[model samples]
Target chain A: MRLKCPLCGDRDAREFHYRGAAKLMERPEAGAGEAAFYDYVYLRENPVGANSELWFHELGCRAWLCVSRDVSSHEILSVELADAVKRGQA
Target chain B: MVDLTGLSALEGLLPYEVDGAVLSAVSYGAITSIMPFRGQKTAVNVRLKADGGAALPRIGRVSGPVAKRLIWAGRGQYLLLDLRRGAAFDTTPDPAFDELAALSDQTSAWVVMRLEGARAQEVLARLCPLDLRAGVFKRGHVARTELAHMAVILWRRPKGFEIMVVRSVAQVAMRRLSGAMDSVAAQAVLGEIS
Candidate 1:
């Protein structure tokens, strides 16, 4: 599948590596307790429908992307720069 | 000071030619990577124009003349090169752009080459997956992509394309490009008789 990089345009999927769920972006506070930290670090939901993911464009623009995709159909719903997501711009 | 000899990555393995395409090593006196400080892009562009007679290139574009040009490397990153200068890095930071952008000399970190001729596109199509048609990938367009599984920055020049590969894999990149050239040339020869 081809993924459209916000900066580099459309590129083959081989150029990008899937990091994990987009939830990886959220980090617990230092005093959030061990259970909360453990859930943040170890628990992952394997949803079958629309899922937000983190992908790194290692070979193209080197931008971290937040990709919304359907897990069952493999259709890419939308893509945004992770930086922009963190900044609440995307 | 010790005497040191500067050698290009493809020192003795370039200037290769096929039936219609020619590949040659390209040397730059200095290659500087310019990445603007957060929210300083406009300031950096203004500084670049005042200092180099060119502004920062947009995505997949180049600024200035061939003698000294700034080519877009990726999002918010650029490579400025002096084509006529010696192959060495100028480590000094220029006050003109230092505060607005992060500058680093990258002269010896890459192997640059120019492939030019009528059939250069055909030769490159075999290795790169990008749609390189003249209309699609017009002149001054650039892309960070893979060429034969090696990361490269490919750009369209007037006649052909310029490819920049990491210095460590210069030989491997050369071999892959040369092999593609030969394959394209042979295909052309076969088409003539059939």
Candidate 2:
């Protein structure tokens, strides 16, 4: 699949590594409960749709990217750098 | 001469404490295939067009005694390979398999970190199936090896070595690697870790 990286331009998926949804973990809330901690560390949520997920370029320039795509249609909605912190997409 | 991460923790007699090479939280990009090629004094890395799109990047050929070593294919396009080193090529000829191979190759979501220090070899030995001894591995070598029980591609550089494993294996690998380096760090510099 092809992803348009906002900073690196359109690149094949081979250029990046998927890290899952942007924010999936909360740094164990200063001594959280056992169940809550287990959920955060052990469980994973796999969703299919247009979701904002995190990615890294392990092969290319090594940049952070945000991508919105469909699992079925193989269509990409949008892609940009890890600039979500600067643009406030976070 | 400089101590690095994990140095002081081992024997506790280390000049200065070194941490081996800690994961800096930097991104090495997603799973990407690396192509290593070389000529006489130069080496080039090119990422192949693995999706059945043939993009052959042309580089000048090696220079030798023109009267002898000029074996010619004449009109055909030449792809340069540094015979001094082993070259990696895209072996996947299947389109459907390319997408999945990309993921296995970490073409989707992954990070690559370069780990080296006085404790480099010790750290790698703990989790890698490959031997990290200098006698077996000199400089300018690369391999698709395994780390922390995951398939990885490791390239040996001058200073130390660089390893790329899956992101999901990060925390676990780090714990094991750090502990391993902490086991060493007594004498050598472990080299520079980036």
Candidate 3:
């Protein structure tokens, strides 16, 4: 299957791995609590609709992408990067 | 003992899983000929039935040929040449790829598995992340890539993709793969060309 890369536009899925979803949830920092870190890393919401996620192109360009996909059909709706700084805005 | 400076052996490469399915590794060495069918390799992978009968279609075929005698024997890749023939490599009427293809076809007698099912794609996805959907990996196609931390030859069959990982890594791959498929289990020995 082919995918529209966030940085390079459309490329084949053979070049990228599906890491899934852009969960901005962050850990509560060190000493905040082990349970908090565990829950944040392990827990995930498997929504099956238009959603955003992360993908690493390990074999290709090796760029991290924030992809908007339809989980139900595994169709990629759109793709972007997690780095807000790439947009150069506040 | 021939001058084997870097030739590797494939022993203990295939290990039996607790559930009883066998995983294996093999090596196809030497650069003999190149056969590309529809841009795919047709190396037949099969499994035997509980009744010792043939079950399903061939796993894959070899499109590009690398050597003459190919062996799924153990855990490593082997490139064999008939050194007995003082004939130079690939300078004869009968090419190396043709001979290897015959050997690959004869192995059809060996029971093999299609390794296909609902989660077959999922199992493969965990290995190479190639997005093995319907359109991408179609029947009669083949790919040589790294899977489950090992080099593997994958064939796209009608039923499911058949793959042979490094025999030494078979056990580890099987364990890691059990978690990939949502389907409960897979068969022990799959048959061929049925």
True contacts kept of each: 0.66, 0.00, 0.00
- State the displacement of the C-alpha of residue B136, model 3, in Å, after optimal TM-score superposition: 1.5
Look at candidate 1 and tell me the lDDT of residue B39.
95
In model 1 chain B, which range of ten residues has the least summed lDDT?
A: B84-93
Tens digits of per-residue lDDT for model 3, B29-130: 222222223312333112113323222222222222222323222111221222122225333323333432322221211222235554466556656645
Instruction: Give residue B154's error in model 1 in angstroms.
Output: 1.1
Flag clash pairs in model 1.
B29-B85, B29-B86
**DockQ metric, candidate 1:** 0.77
Error of 3 at A4 (Å): 13
Q: Write the per-residue lDDT of candidate 1 for residues A1-90, one digit (tens) a residue.
A: 988899988889988999999988888888999998899989998999899999998888788999999999999999999999998942
Residue range B1-194, candidate 1, lDDT tens digits: 88898878788888999889999998877788999989999998788777755888888888889888889998778998876653364555576786888898888898899999999999888898899999999988889998888889989899899999989999999999999999889988989412
**In order, what DockQ does each candidate have?**
0.77, 0.01, 0.03
Where does model 2 sit among the CAPRI classes?
incorrect
Model 2 alpha-carbon miss at residue B77, Å: 23
What is the full ranking by lDDT, best candidate first?
A: 1, 2, 3
Tens-digit lDDT string for candidate 3 (A31-84) = 878887777677777776877778765443355777778878878787765554
